[model samples]
Target: MRRSIPCLCLAAALLAPAAVQARVAQARIARMHTPVATLEQVQVRLDWAEHADSGQLRIRAGRVDAPALGYHFRDLTWTCPLRRTPEDGWQCEGALRGQGVAQRALALRGQGAAPLRLGIHFDVDALTATLAQGQARLALERRTATPDLTTLILTRVPLVWAQALLAQAWEGASFGKGTLDGRLAIVAPAAAPLRVSGPLRLHAAALQNADSSIVGEGLGGDFQLAYVGSAAARVTVAGVLHGGEFLVGSTYVALPPAPVGLHIEADSAGAEGWRLPRIEWRDGDVLAGSGRARLAPDGNVRELELQAHSGDLGPLAPRYLSGWLGVLGLSGVELRGGVDMTTRIEDGALVEVTAVVRDAGLHDPAGRFGFDGLRGDLRYSAEAPVDSQLQWTAGELYGLEFGAAAIPLRSGDGTLRSRAPWRVPMQGGSLTLSDVAIRPAREDAGADIRFGMALEGIDFGRVSKALGLPAFTGVLGGEIPSAHYANDRIDFDGGLTLHLFDGTVRFSELALERPFGTAPSLTADIALKGLDLARLTEVLGFGTITGRLDGSIEGLRLVDWTPVAFDARFASYPAPGVKQRISQRAVQDIGSVGDSSFMASLQGQLIGLFSDFGYRRLGIGCRLENQICTMSGLSGSAGAQDENAFTIVEGSGVPRLDVIGFNRAVDWTTLVQRLLAAGKGEVAPVIE
Candidate 1:
């Protein structure tokens, strides 16, 4: 009885009008059910002549439930007058209104037959949906029991509006506002689950999230999805993103305004949630990858195998991987390389990485390092406890040039170590690397490094040129038993020896902090021995001083390549090769540094008459701290207990000059200025 009323009323409305006594007719359907939808308490009212063929029909106060779609509609009201049609079975025109995110406004028309048929047309803001059905499937178990439906064929529908029908929400991510237009077909079996399949085009679409994990603007693409069943459903997603930025963790990728193609196919993996047999991402001239992935039972990423290639890695770094590099204090650096790599991940962690670089170049504008013509094939894997080999052609670091090298690494026990010692030529010197141990990249503590370095027969002329230091000729050689590069610092355990000025200089307790950051710092202790005084004076433009020189400088610190603090003293060695003599100008310069006048063995009247003088001994010292220089070391100390007066240069023979220093504590700035001016021959005469 409930099933027959819709056909009866539809037939009556389609028939022609006739003259007869007026009567009102109405009936109610307790329930109407489809595989995907259900409507209850449907009321139908008819108002027209009893003898007439056509009448006004109204369906109101109904509710619908589509649990699979997350939709519940209440207060559903439909009012339309059905009339007899010459060619059509039954026709009615009015509105059907419901309260839900799905079809809210729909125009309904139906026909009466063995199986009912209906046309649903929906139109709303920036969206429209139309369904013209040929026939509706009836359930075999209850064909005549009540209103039951099984299948639907949508001839026309808007795709964007269909997104509201899907019950899905991605955590921490969302798509920006836009419209999608296209078509789709929905199939529901009485015994099987519902399925939706089609191609939907995104128009002017965009996406953004709080973490910027998936951000894109002005994006337009087409995506296709087809689902068969929930238990073992195999769904493949294929789409293209027009332009956007994509970042996963610290790895970032960018796209231009042009289209970027992507394809993926996933199949049920029983206990393991899903397995992707094919995956692809393509961006012309930028980046491309092909891969496969697996998901755990809980839908978390389990494993991934990918092969990617990049033509240029320089521009790709700043937009995507800058944050990761910043952890190592390498921000604002430029990187360029033709890169080819294969990465394998297992248990949601990176297990293997293999990469080959072609024509790689990295440049730091701050001038710490810049290298080109670099190439290498580097490999690391958890499976192979050892047996990794890396070969590079050449590189430059800190203005020091180096030759090619091949390094083989062994890995095990949570560390990667060099299988054998490695040696390379750097700036006319050989640098040997041994016992190099590096932590794995995947470890939480960060990939720190520890190694030992030995230098042999390195020429200081080249070193001076590399460091932009003042002219000094020497051979530098040393061995540091241990050096650690971790926590943004490089510290050495042993000393470095330099053969300079026909003598040796030893440096110890060296450390470099934040080598690539602003205000890089270096600290060390230095001991100088047997340096030729005449050559040193000539090279530094400090007038002239005879005899060999020896001294020690302690507590030396350099911030941003400038000496900030140190205690240094140099005295002429007693056993020396050259005659002990001091040029007149040298005395004047020394006088200027000491803030004093010249004292002479000759009478004061004879001092001004000598062009130069012989000196018995010469020494100087300064303890610099807080921009103040405390000076000491004068020949033949003053008999008086005056802190400011000390004899510096002791005269030997006739016309000998004795220099007395009157300032014990002097401003470093003033001393530096006086020394610079004296080197340029700008010192004024000192008369006391």
Candidate 2:
């Protein structure tokens, strides 16, 4: 009987497991959903199934559409086998695993009734709500109308793990493996202010984006944010940046390392809705700036007191003013030496800027503009003009070198004006600047200026040599009463006059487009009167032609200072005591227009016999466009419609020689080659 009893007990013990397992029922749900469920953008969907006997409810194919938060959760499954811990409580949760920052393994527990209480956890410690592994502790107190102060406390959570929270703040936010440690209290009540307060810290952070616009590396920061009023508009924030390199859409600011920190304290109150009363930045001992700024009624910077000291301008320019410098085509401009400046703003306008640079020097990568040993004291005031003096030991403009000179300046009306006319020596002559005003570059691209220039008598001989052009003997002078600079373009309102070849040549309507950038353009209208052809031809080596020449070149455009297009015409001025003669070589050079057949019938063979011929008149015109030159001659020949009957050198007396142009349209490039060939004495007489 005892053996039988033991056997019965063993059999019962073995059957107990099967009996307990048999009582558990599992079911898959299908197409069962609760419409209009709240909790932001979460959609609650469940498959209908009756596992009521087993106390289990499985939810499958759950998805949340949160487009506003830039998030999508798919492939979601929740298994909530009902337990008797609470009469109407559910432990519905699943491993949310997929792409993006929302991927996580969570266990959610909640009650199925009103005034709902829900809790979600990733990795929790024995201490009920100790967050870990991107876990969050959330609690909400609610009523029939709305919820109040939904508290969310997270610890040791990856910063990027809060994509939904971050998406509500900014676009395309990318953060690194930094842990977020903080408790955030938020309230969303109807007809009440949305209040949020928290002490947040990001540790060991390195954040960057696909576009280099919002990039920060090795960033560590803390912010104590408190808001008891309406949505963000009335919020106060106190933040401190320990160290980092922050790049915000073309502007990059970086902090060095330890005690060198950057602090920000801002509030929304007073005359201005928001103002920064304590803004400080420190970079070791090399750079430091502390300032306060108040926002205007429209939320722009209205008042400010900023003082900056830098041991080197080389780094400061790139870190702070790269955007503005790039607009001025001065990127990669090297600057060195100590710089100190104090600036003030009033009503969103610059009030004053007191700056002093010591032993400063600049090296331009473009080699167009640069200065060395620059010492300057600049005091600019909005109300009254100040005495500012600028001195440089050496300088270069457009690759031209000049000695050191002190330039005096004054300021008013948001412009820096020259106090007196300054003489800049160039080409053994003086270059004077008067009425010079300059509006410095700012963030909004509010930079423009107007100035006047007067050149006394600049020798063109040295100017020609300096410019690498043919030796020209003339006195260059000009009066530009209003040279305006705006939108990267400079236009001269007056003209420059040149006395050369016993004549006058004037240039008007001159403008320089993108003066310091790629392919600068110069446009002007040039008029010449009563010019000696002998001296001109001798200087240009264009084969001696003795005659008084007058010409006009309108709409002349030069790109990179090289003539690209023009409508030019030159002809005998018909003045007293002027002999019109064309050298034999010159006749051959001009006859090369058609060379053989074009000049054959026009004394081509006879032209080679005379050393020089007396011509009744001489005329030449070229209308260049689209790389083609439309050639013409004197009024009589210029208007000649016969294809091969345009006279170039009209004969007067015996031993007559008449050179004519037969082709009206010629390739400018080809004509230039021909002209160069003729200049080299390569013109050959082709007799047919």
- Per-model TM-score on C-alpha atoms: 0.70, 0.70
lDDT of each: 0.68, 0.64
Candidate 2: where is the Cα deviation over 4 Å? 1-93, 96-261, 268-273, 283-287, 295-303, 440-445, 574-578, 593-606, 638-641
Q: Model 1 clash pairs?
A: 14-83, 14-84, 635-647
Count of residue pairs whose backbone atoms collide, per candidate:
3, 2
Q: Write the per-residue lDDT of candidate 2 for residues 272-317, one digit (tens) a residue.
A: 4457778787765467898998764334467889998988777777
- Count of clashing pairs, candidate 1: 3
- Scored by lDDT, the top model is 1
Which ten contiguous residues of candidate 1 have the minimum total lDDT? 121-130
Candidate 1, residues 1-688, lDDT tens digits: the string is: 1122244344344333321244565667788765666778877666776666666667664677766554577776555656545544455544445564223222112343121222222112111112222221111111222223222223223223334343232223445445564444555667876676777666655554446644555556777867654556677778887655555555555556777888988877766567889999887656789999997644456799999989988766765567677767777778887889998888786777778878888887767777666676666666767476776677778888888888887765557789999998888879999999887556356567899999999989898988876688989999999999887789999999999887889999999988887688999999999888788888778788878888999999989877789999888767735788888888888889888777644366677777777877888899999989998875455522466687777778886567778888999999989988888778865754
